[model samples]
Each structure stands twice: as structure tokens, then as C-alpha cells.
Target: MGLNHINLVVKEVDQAVSLFADYFGFSLITNRNSKMAVLERSHQFVLVIWGQELNRKDEIPEYPENFHIGFYQEDEGAVREIYNRLKEVEGLKLDSEPKKIRNTFGFYFYFEKLMIEISVNPFKENIA
Candidate 1:
């Protein structure tokens, strides 16, 4: 088996849902009372968003300093396109512009408390 799904706990469910849907092209699979949402990408991968209610303070979780979700494209141009689109997204914060990182072209940014990275695998064309 590869991987099933990932659940992300966020402060605002709608914002997180919108951001992911816009960037990853996910389709909303389920919406539960404005508190939870399930999104699907490519039919095989699932992303579940859980809203942390302020009334339940103890249930809120913290993320590690470098924790992030990543997405990969096939080419450098696609990565740049995503970076540029991210720059245009209102209220979203970009950590930096796209640049060479090791052998890939990529960039990272913040979506609320989550860190997101999108990159292109430079060696993809070399794979047999």
C-alpha cells in the first residue's frame, strides 16, 4: 500500500479548505457542520480538515517547527506557475520566491499554521 490520507487540524476549516482546494485542485468530498471537511486529490489521496474549536482549548495541537506538506510537479515551469499564483492569493503568506533547492526548483509558504512546499523534481526526466 502507498498511503491512505492525512488529517490536518486547523483553526479555520473554511479557510484551510479553500486554500487547499485552490492550490491542490481538490474536490470537496465531505463538509461536516462547518467544523470538518474532507477533500480529495486525484481520487486516490484524501485530505481531512478538522476544525479546532476555541471553546475546547485543550484539544488544540501544536506543530513542529519544520513540519510541512509538500506537492510536486513535473517541471520547473509548473513550480514557478504555482509560486506566482501563490503570490497572488490574497491573505496567504509566501515565505519566499521559487528558487533552486538542491536539484529541484521549489518554494515554501505558510497557510495559517501549516507550512507548504511545492517543487519540481529535476531528475524526473532521467528516470527510466
Candidate 2:
């Protein structure tokens, strides 16, 4: 079977929802409450964001050093377009401009505690 959905725990559900909806083209499907939201992309991918308040601990969640979620674009130009748009966001910690990273052309950045990668693989016909 194919993969279904990803549930991400973030410090603020609304902020995460805005990032995915406004920048990544994800449509807000529903908000379960102030603590959770569901988003969907054109390809039927679901992204669920859960607020940190649901956790038993009282601190921020920390992912492994190199752990990140990535989105692939159709081409380098598409990747660069996203990079440029993200650069204007007030407090996003973008690593740098898109460049060759191993076999892909892309860039990385942190939104709150989540590290996200936007890239394009030149050799791949389908980027999904």
C-alpha cells in the first residue's frame, strides 16, 4: 500500500497551518480544535499538525539532528521560487539559497522546531 499521512507535533498549530497552507499550497481541511488541524494537498497528501500541548512533557520536542521533512518540486526554478518566497517571511531561519546538495538542488530551513527541505532532483522524472 502507499503511504497515507504524516502527523507533526508543533509548538503552535495555527502557525504551522499557515505555513503549509499559504506557502506550500496545502488546503486547510479542518481544525479539530485550537490544538490540531488537518491539511491536504492537490495530490491527496494529508498533513496533520498537533499542538505541543497534547504532549505530557512541558518542553519543546526535539527531532534528531539530521531529521527533516522534504518537498520536491518539478524543477530547479520551482525550488528557487519557493526559496525566494520563504525568504520574505519574517522570522524563518533559511539556511541559504538553493544549491546542489548531493544529487538534488535545494535548500533547508527551520520553522519553529521543524527542519524542512525544498528541493528538485534533476534526474528524476516524477518528483512526487
Candidate 3:
């Protein structure tokens, strides 16, 4: 089976949605106060956002090193593009540079308490 999607616990759903819409090419499809709010790209990769109470009930307590959301960039240049864009984005911190690791190139950035990684998915096989 394919990896379905990840749900983020966000205080501000609109802010979180807009941020991804603006920078990561996401477009909103549906949202609810309690149910998951969904965003999709042209590729149909989905991002689901959940509110606070739901998060407390459902998600595990994350450690500092673990991120709630992670994105994989297509290639090194795409990773760099985001690295440059991070300068203009307000609420983010760089975890590492857009450099090579094994067969992938990537960088990690944080928004509030959430850490998102952008990297090349180097495997040709669909393990997901």
C-alpha cells in the first residue's frame, strides 16, 4: 500500500494551510473544525491538518529530533530552491544544508515545533 498522508497538529489551520499553499504549492480541497483538512498538489500528494484537541488525543508526544511533517524534494535543485525561499518565510529554522546523503540531497526546516524535511526520494522502487 502507498503511504497515505501525514496529519499535522496546528494551532492555526488557515495560517498553516496558507503557508503551504504559498510556498509548497498546496491547494485546499476540504476542511472541518474536527475532521482533517486536506490539501493537494497537481501531483495529488496530500497534506492533512488537524486541530489541537485531536492531536492530543491521537498523536504521540514527539521528541525534539522528530518532526511532525516531512516533505521530499525531487532533486538537489529543488531542495536549494526551498533553502532560498526559507529566507523569505517567517517561521522556520534550518536543520541542515541542502547537501548529499547517500543517494539523496536535502535540508530540514522547522515551523514552530514542527520539523519538515525536503529531500530527493532516491529509490526507484515504490516501497511506500
Candidate 4:
């Protein structure tokens, strides 16, 4: 089995959408009001952000340092580039540097109310 998508319930969909699109180059596929937006990386997978019904901080899950979304990358150099790029962002916390993992290279980082991990990898075709 494979993973389909990750849905993040956020307090500000616009903010989250822009952060992903601006930082990671993902594009917005659609928006359900200002409360929700769907982002896509090519045609493969999506990250959907759904905002608060009442706009209350207590209502949404707080972004934690350890909680993150990880994406696959093609090479170590590319992974390190991302790591350096992310270093400029204010108040960002990282779990680890971009490093090799089971032949994949990537990093994990988190910011206020959001977390992400992006990498480059060719789509895996079924092989035996």
C-alpha cells in the first residue's frame, strides 16, 4: 500500500498555503473558502490544509517541534541545499540535517503552526 495525502487542520489556510507554495514550489490546486486549500506537487500527491470553523487557537492542533511532514529527495547535495535554505527562516526548528536514509536523502524541520520535509526522488515503479 502507498500513502495518499496528508491533511493538516490549520488556523490560517492562506498563510499555510502560501508558506508551502512559496517555500517548496508546490502550487495551489483549489481553495474551499479562505479556510481550506489544496496544494499539489506535480500530479503525484497533495497536501490539503483545512482551517478553523470558529477561528479559535484552542480549536486547532498546535504545531509541535517533533511533528513534521517528510518528502523524498534524489540526492544528498539537493537535500543539503534545502537545509541551508531553511536556515534563513525565523524561529524554524529542525529535527535533523539532510542525510541518507534507506537510500533516500531528506531533512525534517518545523515552524510555527506548520512543519515540512521536501526532497527529490523518481516515482517508484513496481519492481521485483
Reference-based TM-score of each model = 0.88, 0.89, 0.70, 0.65
| Backbone clashes counted, model 1 | 0
What ranking of all candidate models by lDDT puts the best one first? 2, 1, 3, 4
Q: Show where candidate 3 strays beyond 4 Å.
A: 31-36, 53-68, 124-128
Give the clash count for each candidate. Answer: 0, 0, 1, 4
> In candidate 2, which residue ranges exceed 4 Å CA deviation?
126-128
The 0-to-1 C-alpha lDDT of every candidate, in the order given, reads 0.84, 0.88, 0.73, 0.72
Candidate with best TM-score? 2
Which lDDT value does model 3 have at 21? 88
Better of 3 and 4 by lDDT: 3
Query: How far off is residue 97 in model 3, in Å?
Result: 2.8
lDDT of 1 by residue, 5-27 (tens): 99898877898888889878999
- Lowest lDDT sum, 10 consecutive residues, model 3, at 58-67
Tell me how far the alpha carbon of residue 63 in candidate 1 is from the true structure, in angstroms, after superposition.
Answer: 1.2
Model 4, 63-119: lDDT tens digits are 655576766555667778878877876666777877655546676676555677766
Error of 4 at 119 (Å): 5.9
Worst 10 residues of 1 by lDDT: 54-63
- Count clashing residue pairs in model 4: 4
TM-score between model 1 and native: 0.88
- TM-score sort, best first: 2, 1, 3, 4
lDDT string, candidate 2, 1-128, tens digits: 86789999887788889899999889998987868899999876899998888885656678889889998898999999999999998768998899999988999999887899999865686546
Model 4: lDDT to the true structure: 0.72
